[model samples]
Target: MEPGATLLNSTLQQTDASVSLLWTLTLVPLSGETPRKGPATMPLFGKSHKNPADIVRTLKENMAILVKQDKKTDKASEEVSKCLVAMKEILYGTGDKEPHTETVAQLAQELYNSGLLISLVENLQVIDFEGKKDVCQIFNNILRRQIGTRSPTVEYFSSHQEVLFVLQKGYETPGSALNCGIMLRECIRHEPLAKVVLHSEHFQDFFNYVEMETFDIASDAFATFKDLLTRHKVLVAEYLEQNYDAIFDQYEKLLHSENYVTKRQSLKLLGELLLDRHNFTVMTRYISKPENLKLMMNLLRDKSPNIQFEAFHVFKVFVANPNKTQPIIDILLKNQTKLIDFLSNFQKDRSDDEQFNDEKTYLVKQIRDLKKPAS
Candidate 1:
C-alpha cells in the first residue's frame, strides 16, 4: 500500500471507535453508490463532541503520527519534498486555496526537526547545484515566519549545533554550504548563543573537516568561510596572532606527512591564510627564508596537479612582494631549464580544459623570456 494510505489507516485504527464507525458509514455510500445514514444525534451520557481541546489534541496527535511514520520510511524524503512543494504553492497563493495558515508553518518545523528534511538533503547525489539552492530558498521562507510564541527560526538554528554539523558534513554539496552559512550567519546576527558556538572547538573541527574533504571550496565552501571570517575578522586576527607559531609548526609537520592528499589540503589552507592581510607579514617572513623557498620550489614538481597549481599561485603571491621577490626569482632562474620542461609537459597534458591553463602558459612564457645568460 502507498505510505499515505497506510498512515491514514493507522490513524483510523487509533481514533475513537465511534468516530471510526461514523467515518466508515459516511464513506460506505461513495464506494458502492448506495445511500447510507450519517451519524445521528449522539448520546449525552458520554463525552461531548463540542470540546475544542479534544479536537485540537486529536489533530496534533494525527499530525505527529504522520510525521513519525514519514521519518521512518525512506519515502519520507519524497513526502517532505512534496510537502515543500505544497508549501511553496500555498506561499504563492496558487494551489489548493485551503488556508493552512499556521498549520503549514508548524508542519515545516516538525519536518525540519525530525531529521527527515536533513536526510533528504544528505542523500541527494546528483550534481544539481541550482536545485539545492532552491531547497535552501524554501527553507529560508519557512524559517522566516513566526510559528507560535517561540523564538524565531534563527534561535532554533543557534541552539541546534549538532544539526548544523550534520548539515555541513552530510550535504557536502557545494550549493548547500551557502545556505548553511547563511543560517549560521543569521544565528550570529540575531542570537548571542551564536558567538559561543562559532568559537567553540567543535565548530573549528567541523571547518577543518569541510576544508579537508570538500573539492571545490571556491564555490560554496570558500564563500561561506569568507563570510564567516569577514563577520569575525577581528577575532580571527587575534587568534592568528596568538597561535601563529603553533599553526606554522603544524603546517611544517603536515608538509612532511605521509598522506599526500591531506598535506596538499593543508598547504592550500596555508596559502589562504597567507592571503589574509593580518597574516601577511608573518607568512612573508616564513616564506622568505631560503630553506622554505627551496622546499616550496621542490613542490613545483609534485605529482598532484592541485598541489602544483596551489604552489604556483603561492609562489606568485610571494614574488609579488619586493622583499620575497628576489629570492623567488633567483630560485626560478636557477631551475629555469627544469621549470621550462615541466611547464611544457604541463601544457601538453592539460586535458581538463581549466581556464587556469592559459594563465599558466602565459606565466611560463614570461619566465622563459626573463631567463638570464649562463655564467
Candidate 2:
C-alpha cells in the first residue's frame, strides 16, 4: 500500500465516523418527561470534545461553506443547518444548568470574537425562514446563557451596536423578519441595546411594519414591538414620557388600523402596559386623553368578538380612572347611555370570568351613576 493511499483512507474513515456520530446524535429517541441528553452534548466538540476552540472553528467553517453555497434558499443547506442546530444543542445542553460549563461560557465569548454572529445576522436575508430560525435559536441560546451575571452574547452585542442595527434592518424582508425579530427581542434583555432601539428612528417604523400585508411578518413585528415596550417597564415608561406625543401618535393609528388583528393585539398590549404597576404615570397620561377613549369606544363596535373583548378591557380603564379630565368625562357622558347599553351586553362570552364580571358590573355602575356636570 502506498503511503498517500493510507493517509487518504484514514482521513475518509474519520469523516465517516463523524458523520455517523452526527446522525446518531440527531436521531436520539424521546422516552420521558425530562429531555434526553444524547452523545456529544458539550459545547462545540461532542461528548469527547477536547478543545472548545476547535468546535468553534469547525462551526465557523461550516457556516462559511453554507453561506457560499446558498445565497437564495436554505432548504438545500440541510447539512449546514443541522450542524448549526447541533452546535446550539451542545452549547445549550439538554437541561437548563447542565450546559453552563466554564468551557461553554468561553464558547460564547469565542463565537462573539470570531465574528460568526455578524455573519448569522447577515445571512438572515438570504437563507430560508427555517434556516433563519435555526440561526435565531442559536442566538436565543447565547442570550439565555450566563457567564457570571449576564449573557455573553448580550454583553458582546451591547458594545457592537452595528450588528443590532443590521438585525433591525431584517424587518425590511419578509423572509428574515420573524427570525430577526426573535433575535432582537432576546437582545433587549441588555439595557444598552434596548435603549438604542427605543430611541432610534427604528422605533417609529414599528407601527408600519406591524401593518405589513404579510401576516406572518406583521405579527412577528408586532410581537417584537410589544416586547420592547413591555419587557423593560421602567425604560419604556421613560421613553413614553419623553416621546409620548410621537409614540402614542403612531400607536393611536395602530388602534385605528383597519386590520382587525392589529386593532385587537394593540388594544391588548395597551391594557397590559397601563395595568402594569410600574407604568402608573403612563397609564394616567393615557387614560386622561379623550381621543384614546373614543378609539376604544369605536373598537367596542368592531365586528370581531376578539377585538371587542380586548377593547372592553381598555375602555374600562378610562371609566375607572378617578381623576378623569373634562375631555374624558365629556366623551363618557355623551356616550353614557350607549356605554351603559354596551357594557350591559358586553362580554357575555366571559360570563365565567368572575373578575371580568365584577369589573364589568363596576364599569356599568360608574357610567350609570355619572353626573351631567355643572352645565
Candidate 3:
C-alpha cells in the first residue's frame, strides 16, 4: 500500500478508538455511576474510516434513531437534543479549516432523504426551546446550502405544506413561538413556500400574534411577520393588490392598538413595505385613501416619539405624491392646520437629523402651499 494510505489507515484507527471511549462514557450512567457534570465534546467524524463521508452517514443514522424517540420525556428529549447538536456540529463544524461543503451538502441531502426534516417539524410541537432552536438552525443550514439549487426542496415542501402551517401554528404556544417563528422565516426564504403562506386564509392570524400578551413571543412573531411581508417583494405586492381592503383593515386596527410597541412596530414595518419600490402600486393605492392618511395623521400625534418618527416616513409618502386623489386631498385640506402644528413640533429631539429636518421643512411648506377649495 502507498505511504499516504497507511497514514490514513492509522488516523482512522485512532479515531475509532476515540469514538469507542466516547460510547463507553455514554453507558456509564446506565451502569449506575455518577453522570458527568457536563456534556463531553464529541468529534464529528468517527468509525474505522474517520472521514467526512463517515461523519455524514453517522449523523444520518443517529438522527434517524433520535427522531423515533418519544420526545415527550425529558430524558428522551434531552438525548434527542444532544443528537441534533452533534449533527449540527458536523454540518456546521468549526476549526481553522472550514467544514467540507460537499460533505455538508451530502449530509443535508441525507436528512431530507431520511425524512428527518418532516420529523423535526412534527417533534417541534413537543421539544424544549433549545431543542427547537437547534432544529431551526439545522433547517437554516440546510436551506443555505440549497438556496439556488434546482432541487427537490420546493417539491418536498409543496407536498408537505402542512409543515409550514405547523410552524405558523407554533406561534400559538409561547414555549415554541420564538424558535418556530425563526424556522418559519427561514422556510419563507423560498418563494414557493412564501406564496403558500401569503395566500393562506390563516395569514390573518399574524395580526393577533404581534399583539399577544407575551412580550418575547409577540416580538419574535413580529420578526417572522415582517419577513413574510417583506422578503418576497413581488409576492407581497401582488398579495396586497388582491387583499388590500381586508388586510389593510387589520393593519389599520394595529395602527390604533392601545399597546405602544405593537403600534410602533406596525408603523415601522408599514413604512418599509411602502418604501420598497416593488410595492409602488400598493403604496400609491394606500396613500390615495383618505382614511389611511387619517390613521397616519393620528400616529403623528402619538405620545411616543418613535411612533411619530415612523409615522412621519409613511406620512411623507402621502405628502410627496404629486397627484393626490380627491379624497386624500380633501383630508389634507381639512387637516392642514393640525398637520402643520404637529410637524412643527414632531421629532424635535432629532434636530441633528438634517434630512428629517429638511423633510419636515418641505412638508410644512407643502401643507402651507395647498390652495383653499373654492366656496
Candidate rank order under TM-score: 3, 2, 1
Q: How far off is residue 143 in model 2, in Å?
A: 2.5
Residue 250 in candidate 3, Cα distance off native in Å: 1.0
What would the TM-scores of all predictions be? Answer: 0.45, 0.75, 0.77
Cα lDDT of model 1 by residue, 135-234, tens digit: 5665555556564655555566566556556555533445455556555444444334444544555444443543445554323444444444445645
For model 3, which pairs clash? none
Candidate 2 Cα outliers beyond 4 Å, as residue runs? 1-86, 89-102, 127-133, 347-350
TM-score of 2: 0.75
List model 3 lDDT by residue over 68-178, tens digit each: 654535556555665666567657764333666776767667676777777677667566667677888887777656546664566677877988898898888767777
Q: Considering TM-score, which of the candidate structures 1 and 3 is the better prediction for this target? A: 3
User: For this target, which candidate reaches the highest TM-score against the unseen true structure?
Assistant: 3
What are the lDDT figures for the candidates, one per model?
0.54, 0.77, 0.78
True-structure Cα RMSD, model 3:
9.7
- Give the better candidate number (1 or 2) by lDDT: 2
Give a tens-digit lDDT track for model 2, residues 87-174: 6655765433356477666767677888877877887665555667778887887777765685666767777777777877888877
Residue 110 in model 1: shift from native, Å?
Answer: 10
Worst 10 residues of 1 by lDDT: 44-53
